[model samples]
Target: MLYQPDTYKIEQDLSRFGRTGNDTFIPGATEEGLRQYRRLLRNNINNTMVQAFPISRQVLPDDEWNELINLFFANHDAKTTQIWKLPAEFVTFVKEKDYATLWGKPWLNDLLYFEWIEIEVYTMPDIEAEPFTLQGDIRNGTIVVNLEYRLIPLRYPVHLYAVEEAKNHPGDYFMMVYRHPETREVLFADLSALDTFTFENIAHEQLSLSDIAAGLKLQFALSDQHPLLINMIAFVQEMMAQKLFLGYAVERKEQF
Candidate 1:
């Protein structure tokens, strides 16, 4: 077999690019090779643009389009003054900086992450907690929330845009994303219905499902015919099958 210098050089360039741990294009790389590498890099970046920048749907002029792509995927070097090796640059940036805001409006990064969480919650081999109906004297004034649940705060609220009533408006909002032991999917609940005091009450385990229903009497009903009740039952069964629900809510008096 003939030794191919071209193939050898390509591999050498790749190895140099990979092992160097720097964003500068592999040294000794020719302009022609660099152009081919950059073309491929740009193609990959274009595919990522939709999720990264939904706003890119608008047609852009060639120069601006190229500039945004470069800013996202390329790293500049002051010495040789070349921009290349986007994968390395992207990885470095993701690790070193909060680069998520480039995708859209300021808070969209957390929205995207929250959206991704549902997929992640659905697919994991471990079973997720399902919604369950409260039993044994879940009455008016009972405050209900998951005992082991976590708020999972972002720097800003990402769920505000999701509220149908707030469709025309934009502001900060926190979400109570939870998975009861029996449910296969995560649930997203807006925390804005409750006052800051109520939110604090839930965190302190001072509220019960019964109490929450009374507080928002019209929003949710406690009857067995309620949609939430049916969903909770089915979810509880699923969680039991998966061993995901432990059925722990704060005991009313114990909450105080």
Candidate 2:
């Protein structure tokens, strides 16, 4: 399109310039002006990627990070008009590129996703908490995890800023991230393997504290006085204070 002499092909020229390097000369546009234009585009994209994946930026070397950004800008086709969501597009690009094999940074994408989720949570629309009343006692009612929260079962503890700490831990790292309705603050909660199990399988509108404890003992051989149980209770109290509890149902639903 740049080689085409038709002045009417403005969109075509611009599109070509956006994808590859510019190969056209506008009537009055200086070469320096064109160079700055490309530079601005790259800088804008790089800035957003940095914003989207701050931790990833810190871990990756300059050459590799710049290459990844350039690769996405040149090849990845963005389907959305929302430029703020480009890093999300980069996630898709990484998966498609087989980033684990190609770049050998399997944990990098996990970190990117972790950081991206924080951005997503911050940008989520505000929701009013439904009117809720405790069923006589705060710890006895059904425990309902808020819909605004994300139960991310990650392979690495990307929440850890220290890369060595993230690297040493191996398996599924369970985390609960929620945005408070009133304060609009994004909060992080860690879930132990037992807590993760209970949240994944046992906690519901039908379950009470006793019910959860019973299920935990039956399934995981955890006794009533287990440290995990004690810690889990404390975690729930914290979550309630943070409004991630979403209050609770007054009457536990019939299991039959």
Candidate 3:
């Protein structure tokens, strides 16, 4: 009966505004009511913590729990029920600079952000075409590729760590994150090796597939039937089929 939706609303409201706002009518009654209300409100608040973040409860002492819960609920509003549906707030709390001192990890957010990106790339919609490699004159500046098939850009290195471990030491990295349309397998690669400039030139309708392939051959100094050329083509086909290649990006030329 106490946990009914309406009762829940009342309790939540008491937890939220019972201490802050003034009650005009029944001033003595309001003050007395607030005393009883805070007890129930604290219980309900702890229930939410039990449900949403059990780990915090297990690891934190009772005194610490109050601070942690209060910190999370400090800005909450009771009238709107939407806040209850929010994901566990511990992750955000632990990542904050102030909280990081408590958690003993400052880079936690960066690591989490990096891991989240991989989850994004793995779930990206299927790209129809497969990866295609070229061996034409790239060094001699003859290679061409679809601009759209250009290099993948990443602000953080998603490949260095698995989804879970990356949440500790996130760093900047750019590389391919590919997926095969049919098999749904993923791939990774370096942008420089794939020639990002050629990929972009092709993406923006700047070059034809044939011309691009020819350019690759020229740039890489390969003959029409070179073994290396054939291998390159096969590699592209595999990358495309499995969606192994992700995205391309240009490196900081000045870094060298």
Candidate 4:
């Protein structure tokens, strides 16, 4: 009689094989065949994780890296169906388990997040920009920032410095990650306190350069608006050149 295994049991066994390289005992499956299947599954995950976190791989030793990833593979139930998005769950797992402390790498979480965000911004779905004019008075017109962007705060300057060096300088660091409009490549920009504030407001609110300057003045306690406005205009112009700013927002004419 040909033995038939429960379909659900087969699925559970396959999942366990992928996670722990355990043997699958289905009928007609040889020990060597099960080993090869397990090896293939493990290798696929290993390759994906390495591609996703190259920097972290470089920083951690072989044993530590293997242990860390193995733990995650065995423990975390990944939610994303997309393989590219699996790295995101790895980041969450590291943070939740406080792996930074376990590994004695205080900046591990920030570095993981910094690297993962680049992947996220690069792979994120395209966002359609609203109607805007390329040539307009930015000072008075509402600004249109690129929708495919992310603003993140870090405790270490992992993006700017090497992992080892970054650990020495622990402080608040802000970064802007955005996809280049034409090339579709992800780029990073370090932000100062004031720059972070300006970018955040522009991204969230439909504000003009003048409005941004006013808010900056109040936030930074500046009495002189002339120089601030001049600087803000220059900043907006630079951002537009980089494709970070689509342009000034324009009113869409309604058709009856």
Best prediction by TM-score? 4
Clashing pairs in 4: none
- Give lDDT tens digits, candidate 2, residues 53-127: 888899989999988888888888778788887777888788678775587676776777777788778786665
Which residue ranges in model 2 land beyond 4 Å of their true spot? 1-10, 22-30, 138-140, 201-206, 216-232, 250-256
Question: Would you give me the overall lDDT of model 1?
Answer: 0.45
TM-score for each candidate, following the candidate numbering: 0.40, 0.79, 0.36, 0.89
- Candidate 1 minimal-lDDT segment of 10 residues: 78-87
lDDT by residue (tens digit), candidate 3, 1-256: 6488866766556645544333423323466667676566656666754655544355456876676566655554334354343322434454553564566534333343333334445565544442334433322222222222224454334346543454455544456544444455444565544444434544454453356567667887866724544444454455434344332222224754
Per-residue lDDT of 57 in model 3: 55
| Candidate 4 regions with alpha-carbon error over 4 angstroms | 1-7, 22-29, 219-221, 254-256
Candidate 2, poorest ten consecutive residues by summed lDDT: 200-209
Write out the backbone clash pairs for model 2: none
Cα deviation of 123, candidate 1, in Å: 5.7
Task: Give the Å error, residue 228, model 1.
Answer: 20
Error of 4 at 74 (Å): 0.5
Each model's total of backbone clashes: 17, 0, 40, 0
Please tell me which model should have the higher lDDT, number 2 or number 3: 2
| RMSD of each candidate relative to the true structure | 11.3, 4.6, 12.1, 3.0
